[model samples]
Target: MAEEKQKKKGGCLKWGAIIIGVLILFGACAAAMTGGGEDTGDTSSDSNEAETTETATEESTEEETEEATEEVVEEESPDAGIGEQLDVGAMSYTVNEVTTASQVGPSAFPTTANETYVVIDLTVTNNGNEAVTVDSTYFKMIIDGATFDADSAASMSANQNENGEITNSFFLENLNPGSTMSGKIVFDVSQANADNPEKALQVQEGIFGTNSGTINLQ
Candidate 1:
């Protein structure tokens, strides 16, 4: 009987050790599963943040592109016409009339063989509080993309008085506030170009001054 009882106690000890080992293994597996689940959740959060940032960056870039395109369109708008008020800053000008002549020299002056003249009747008004100077050098005639300056001497010699008298040339004059002056500018060009001049003329207020844009001459 004593030997049987001892054997039974040994069996109980062995079974108890086996059950404890199984419980420990199960706990380890559960810990590993929980850690893996936490890692997956962190990765998902990082991915969502990255996606949101990329979307915001794309939207900002699109807005900037649209604004730049609008600016370019405004800059490329077409200019105004002749006999229309063109204000560069403080002064204004208008081309009242345009004429082409076979030749324009002193009443009895000789003419060039292949040269002709284009005259522009201009009116300038000083809109500023102070005086401003208007010079013929600031004017140019564009013919087939070519630019020509006014010929003041030849212009003064043309359209003379009956006694061979000459009119005052329109150049280098000061205009006071609310004052208006009307005069003519003459340009010598080839006969072919004079007959078919460019459709626009350029008027400026100073050397390298602000452009009043191309005025329609047709």
Candidate 2:
């Protein structure tokens, strides 16, 4: 009976040791699994945060670029007032008038003799804002399909002439704005040899031939 009791106590001790070892191993495994799960969750959260940051940065950059482009366009645009002034400069013209004729030379000459010369009076006004100076020599008269140079025309005064009819032949020199200049032209026209009254006094406006402006008899 003593030997059997001793054997039964030894068996109980072995069983207790095996149970303690199994419990210890199971606890270690559970802890390791939990730690691995936490690491995976942390890595996923970090990746999401990084992606969000990159998207925000790209959006900010695009907005900044758009704003900068708009600013540059505004700065480079021309002022409305300046643009209007430039338009006015391109369409400017001068005003001119032909004056009446006066008698020259001896007034008592024989009726048949061509002693009386006709004069033309011209007044030119500059309507532009710029200063202008015009030369009388550039002017000519077209009478009855015939062109009369300024040099050949007789003159009694700077702005008065003995010619019965005349027109502008040339436009020379710069005419300043808001200024007036006067000149006279003279011609010797016999009543019989005179050209058509209407066509005799034509004036040209520009420097180029056939491209000049014409003024009808007043």
Candidate 3:
């Protein structure tokens, strides 16, 4: 009986040792798996954060670029919606009628390349106490950003037999204070510009080219 008891105790010890070994191996595998999971999770979190930061930076840059472009466009564009009342020096001027003609009277004056006549009927009142000379030099036309001087010969030819103290031409005239003179001023321009009156501009300068103001015909 003593021998059997001893044998049984020995068997118990062996089984205990086997169970302890199995437990140790299981714990080691679990630790390795947990460590690997932690590493993978950290790497994935870092990658996501980097992607988010990069996307935000790109969006901000694009917004800034768009805003800058808009500002540049605004600055480069010309002013629109002119052509109202204008006071230059001591003279107040008004452009009442504007017309375009392919031919002046029965004959067409000789012009350089693609030229056409533009007639503008204007009324000028001298507000100053002294007389002021209103001449062709006071008027200019801007087309497609290019300026053209008034054509005196063409204007004279257009209003050849027209009667009135103030002839139908942009004749050099002296106006006394409170007196108003109304006449037409003619200009020679390219047909390309005449075709697109939306791009035409009229500029008037007061005595000695002072107090200039612009009117947009378009």
TM-score of each: 0.70, 0.35, 0.53
RMSD of each: 4.1, 17.6, 8.5
**Tens digit of per-residue lDDT, candidate 3, span 47-111:** 99999999999999999999999999755423323334557657676777677876564233333
Return whichever of 2 and 3 wins on TM-score.
Answer: 3
Taken over the whole model, the C-alpha lDDT of each candidate is 0.75, 0.49, 0.70
What lDDT tens digits, residue by residue, belong to model 2 across residues 43-149?
Answer: 99999999999999999999999999999975542222111211112222222333333343333431122443445555556566566445545445556667755
- Lowest lDDT sum, 10 consecutive residues, model 2, at 79-88
Q: Could you tally the backbone clashes for each prediction? A: 0, 16, 0
lDDT of 3 at 92: 74
What are the per-residue Cα lDDT tens digits for candidate 1 across 1-218?
99999999999999999999999999999999999999999999999999999999999999999999999976652455767877766767788988877666554673442477777777878888888777778777777788888886656655344467644456577778999877777888777777784556777665676545567777
Summing lDDT over every window of 10 consecutive residues in candidate 1, give the lowest-scoring window. Answer: 105-114
Best by TM-score: 1
Q: Which stretches of candidate 3 lie over 4 Å from their true place?
A: 1-83, 106-114, 162-168, 198-207
TM-score of predicted model 1? 0.70
State candidate 3's TM-score: 0.53
lDDT for predicted candidate 1 compared with the true structure: 0.75
